[model samples]
Target: MNFKNNKILSALLLLTLTYTTGCYKDKSNDGLTPINTVQITDPLTAGTVTVFQGDVLRLKPTLTLSMTEKMDKLEFSWLVYNSNGQISLASPRAVISNQYELNYLIQGEPFILGEPYIVRLAVKDTETGVISYINYKVSIGNKYGTGWLVLEDKAGNGDLSFIFPDSTVEHQIYSSRNTAPLVGPKKLELTPFVITDGISDVGKRLYILAETGSQEYNYLTMVKKFDYGFEFYIAPTIQKPTVMTWLSTTSGSTRSANIGIVINNGKAHSNLVGGFPGTKKWGDIALTPQGTTNYSLAPYAVGGPGVAAMIYDNTSKRFYNIIAFSNTPGAGSLTAFPAIANTPGQFDLNNVGKTMIFQDSSDVVHTYNSVMKGDDNLPYLYRYKTANTSTATPNLSISNIQMNAPGILNYTAAASSTNTGHIYYSNANVISRYEVGSNSIVETYTFPAGENVTAIKYAKYNFNDKEAVKRARLVVGTWNGTEGKLYYFALSQTGSIGSYTKQFTGFGKIVDLAYKY
Candidate 1:
């Protein structure tokens, strides 16, 4: 009876349930947005744009895009290529806006004169990953084709040619330009030197000085400036004199910015600038810096800007402690040079009486170094130890005790610190090197037969690598009568000729190689 009562009491206990709830409303609605299309306006036809080589190429395209999405940013890769679709030059990867403009230096291993090239714009949207390509056919004119410039036909006259660095494209640009008439066309035998304003930007007129390989080879008669038209500027009153450098104006928009072009055939440097009709006292080649009335002597083989500039006059057979730019306001005059001249007969006159000076691109002290041969056609390395004071005189001293490259031509050397560098030279049909350091004396690299070297050089063309080691490669100009080559020996960290990198063969007789920035 107790169990039944307990069960009945439990069952009789009534349970009541209640539910608590709140109504909810949708707070937001959304959907993905997308781009429709992108188009390039302006230059609808991409009319021909004639520009000098090494100049800046500005490409600002008006963009018309039909899209529903907001673009975070636009990425662009502007390239200049050939019909082969192989890229020759590429601009930096740029994160751009609608108003972004494209700027690129028209140089590198490609972009030749008189040839058709394509300027391609590969643009992409950061969000959608959609890319648009726009290409333009370009015909270059009067643009300096880069690489090795050959002065061939030393037999009767001379011819100018070029070879690109990639080792594929070579062209006879000079003749194609038909510039002979402008420079007084004549069958000439010359060992020429082409120099750009070392202190100026690219696109500056290139100066060509043709030296007669005759007596002393010191006679540098004609000074030709390569521009839209071949400008024959300086024909010094004193004929048969070599015009070295114009110590180009430190800065200016006019042509007479230089104090004077160092014009001498083994004589005193004429600092006298400015010319008057029938006036023998006038100076044709400006050696005077702008706004300076005083004369400035030009350096023959001189390099470096800040600490010091290495100076050597092949004609004078002398070098100076400092080139004495000493442009401390009033010092730009003849006093700009040292009172005493140092004639260190370190090089041979047979190299067309040519001298070369180089300093590390990254160094400020300007530890200048040079390489040349003497009467024996052998290469020698010379180092310029910086003087404690700028006023102290300095001359290049032989590095190794007796290190010499045998039967060398177009020999060049580059060094950063003392004895820390390498030298490369052309010997017959082979290439060789002379390593310098506090350690070993010299080392040589001999290429196989038929690798005939005609010229040698190393300049600012690091090619896409601004951080590239300054003298990473020893650039050599070579040819086998019909084919020209721009060969280089890549140097190792220890300054040894590590490997044979790349070379361009085609043109003919790569006589010399120089770089414009």
Candidate 2:
């Protein structure tokens, strides 16, 4: 019994075992029926499906199955999944019809707006006990997509209303959607759509300023995001917001990502809402041009879009400019406009001397216009021209003219035309159109006896709508002591007011109106 005898015996046993295993086979499906493959022919593959809320969603998938497989043998179910391709445990599987088609009303149940909810259909073979799954990414869109936002205040309580493109109004949207009502509305503005480092939201957002506090909301869905304090790393001690505006990187760009300026209690705060990280929060109050001197800034800023904004100082009665504030690179400091020796008596950028009534950019780039009240109790319009860059030098005064129209000093709200030389000002129940070039009132219209003008905004919408419908029109809001009405007046080519085109009633005192794109 040596090593050779042991090796020969092992080889014989291995051969016998291999022969037995190869000859014998399992008979599991030898005479059984084969499971039919469910082929969806319509959608071809799993993909995304888009549907607007409040609309009927119909999905009738075309399937190809074997003749032996009856329609009753296949049971179907629809369930929602998270955007990350995982089943949503918080959502209960809805009992959509067991039939091959799905016709369910999208009451916004289990479907969140702008979220990609994966809708899966489970097809189970009752007889064979086999199941097949097909997934479709479904997203809900808003019905109130593009429109205008109107802020109305009934005494101290504030609420919001949405006006559709066709002038259809849905009132009290803020109260109906949220648990608490908005209080003491001041202004309503929007943050432009921004794409920062390949990450962006579903749509723009609304920045609402009120007496209670400030908050941001989804422009499309009207859902609250966060309060004003969330935007600052170290929130400011005072929360009184006077004015806010989103600055664009270019004058013509629809998207903005450069800067946003907010004035809280005469102090300027800067927030970089888009672009690089570390700039999303609000920086400290901007410093004065001369670090040694303390100045009180006016509650308004003029220019942006890659240029430093011009702000007026009430203490010094002069003009100052500042760019976006950044802590890492040191906070932005206001710089004084350089003195101009060319114009002696006309105007001076460094020493305006007059109190600023209003300041805004004209339709032309680099051209800024301001309404100032002189020491003689008269209002004048002054124009300042500059370049459209961050490093541009302030030019000399373009034009300085005295507004010689009647009741100019008593004007409540003023809006200048973007494409013409017409300036519309409201005083009591009268709206006067004064031509800047002529220095005289061209036309004047008085509203009904008790209607006083509350807000006046020139229609300069950038939306791609009918030119005749949105162009060269003036939006005039009037209050008859108790109720408010919005009037639309079509302007002639010469800037003359024609008959009222349309009007909206059934609103409280309209405080502010902004056209949403």
Q: State every prediction's TM-score relative to the real structure.
A: 0.48, 0.76
What's model 1's TM-score? 0.48
Could you tell me the TM-score of candidate 2?
0.76
Model 1: CA > 4 A from native = 1-151, 163-170, 179-203, 211-234, 237-243, 248-260, 268-299, 303-318, 321-365, 370-381, 385-420, 438-442, 465-471
Candidate 1: deviation at residue 397, Å? 8.0
User: Tens digits of per-residue lDDT for model 1 on 191-215?
Assistant: 2232233322223334443443211
**Reference-based lDDT, each prediction:** 0.43, 0.71
Residues 459-500 of candidate 2 have per-residue lDDT tens digits of 765354466545677888889989989888877657788678
Q: List the residue pairs that clash in candidate 1.
A: 167-504, 220-241, 258-288, 259-286, 259-287, 259-288, 260-286, 260-287, 260-288
Candidate 1 lDDT (Cα, whole model)? 0.43
Give the CA lDDT, 0 to 100, for residue 146 in model 1: 43
